[model samples]
Target: MSQSGIDLDRSLGYLLKEASSALRTAMEEVLRPLGMSVTHYSCLELLAQRPGLSNSELARGAFVTRQTMNVLLQALERDGYVTRPAEAPVGKVLPARLTPRGQQSLEQASAAVRAVEVRMLSGMTETERSAAFRILRSMIHSLRDGDGNDGA
Candidate 1:
C-alpha cells in the first residue's frame, strides 16, 4: 500500500457516488417541469414496459419501500393515470397497468430523460461507454454478492 493519506478525489466509491448524485439531479431538473419525481417516472416506465406488475415488484424495481410505492400507486390510480381491479385477481396482489393518459405522460418524460442521457454520453466513445457498462455491472455484482443479496 502507498504510505499516504486516502485521497477521496481518486476514490472509486466517492466518484461513483458523485456521478450518481449528479445523474439524479439532472433527472430531477428535467422531470420537475412535468410534475414528476424520479420514482414516479420509474414506476410508470416499469408499468409501461411490463404491464400488470404488482406494487411490491414496482417498489423493488424503483428501490423504494413497498409502503412508499403503494402510496404513489394509489395517487396514480386516483388521477386516472393507472388502473387496478376492484379486487386482486389472485393472492391479494393487485396488478397495475398504465392508462392512455399515463402513456401520453410517459412519452414526454421519456423524451426528457433520453435527452439527459444523450447529453451525459456525448463525450464518451462507444467503446468507453461499453466498458463503463460492464465495469458498473461487475461492481454491482461484487457488492451484492458480499451483502448476500442476489437481487432475485
Candidate 2:
C-alpha cells in the first residue's frame, strides 16, 4: 500500500493502464517503419472496415479528439491516402473513404499490428486467451453501464 494512495502493486486499473501503454509502445515500434502512428493506423483500419465514416466517427474509434482526427484526415487526403468530397453530402459531414494506396498501407500496418498482438498474447494459452477477452469485454460493459452509456 502507498502512504498516500491506493497500492500500485495490487491495483488492477494501474496494471491495465500499464498493459495498454506497453501495447501502444509495441504498436508504435512496429508501425514506425510503415510511416504511421498508432492513431494513423487506427484511422486507416477503421476506414477500411467502415468506408465513408465521418471525422467524428473516426475520432471516437481512434480515441482521438475530433480536431485531431480532422487534421489527420486532411493530411491523408493531401497524401492521396483518403478522399472526401469537396462539399459535404449532408450537413457539414464529409465522409471519408480510403484510396487504393491507403488500402496497401493498411495491409502492411495490419500485418505489423497483428504481429504485436500475437506477441502480446504469446504467453497465454488459447483457453486463457478466450477467458481474458470475455473478462475485458465484461469490464468495459460494466463500466459503461455504471456511467449510463450503452457503449454504442
Candidate 3:
C-alpha cells in the first residue's frame, strides 16, 4: 500500500499484468512477419496438438470468445489452413483440424514464438525456469478457482 493507494511497483498482480503485456507485445512482433497473430497461432497450435478440437474448445484454449474463434475459423477454412465438416457428426459441434498448410504455418510461427520465449528466459537458470513453470501453473489454478491461496 501507499499513501496514494496501491503500490504498483510492489504489487504482484500489477507485475503479472505488466509481464503479460510485454509477452504479448513480443509475440506479436515476432508473429507479424509470419502473417499470424498470437490467437491465430494459438488456434493452429491447439488444433495440431489436439487434432479435433471444437470451436468452443479452441476459443477457450486460445483465451478468446467463441464468436472470435468462429470468425477466425471461417477465415482459416476459406484460406485452406483448416477444415471443418459441413455438418456436425454429433450435436452441432464441428471439430476443427489444421490442414497441411496450417501445419507448415504453425511450424514457422512456433519457431518465432519459441525464439521470443528463449529471449525472455535468456538469463534464467534451468532450476529457475522449472520453478517459474510450477509457480505460474499454481497461480493459474488458484485464479481459475477464485482463490488466491492454493493451500501450498
Residue 16 shift from truth in candidate 3, angstroms? 0.7
C-alpha RMSD (angstroms) for model 3: 1.9
Instruction: Report clashes for each candidate as comma-separated counts.
Output: 0, 0, 0
Tens digits of lDDT, candidate 1, 24-126: 8999999999989999999999999999999999999999999999999999999988999999999999999999999999999999999999999999999
Residue pairs with colliding backbones in model 2 are none
lDDT tens string, model 2, 33-128?
Answer: 988999999999999999999999999999999999999999999999999999998899999999999999999999999999999999999999
lDDT of 3 by residue, 1-55 (tens): 6897989999999999999999999999999998889999999999999988999
Please give the ranking of all candidate structures by lDDT, highest first, separated by commas.
2, 1, 3
Where is the poorest 10-residue window by lDDT in model 3?
142-151
Candidate 3: deviation at residue 78, Å?
A: 0.4
Score residue 143 of candidate 3 by CA lDDT.
Answer: 74
CA shift of 133, model 2, Å: 0.2
- Judged by whole-model lDDT over C-alpha atoms, candidate 2 comes out at 0.97
In model 3, the runs with Cα more than 4 Å from the true position are 1-4, 146-152
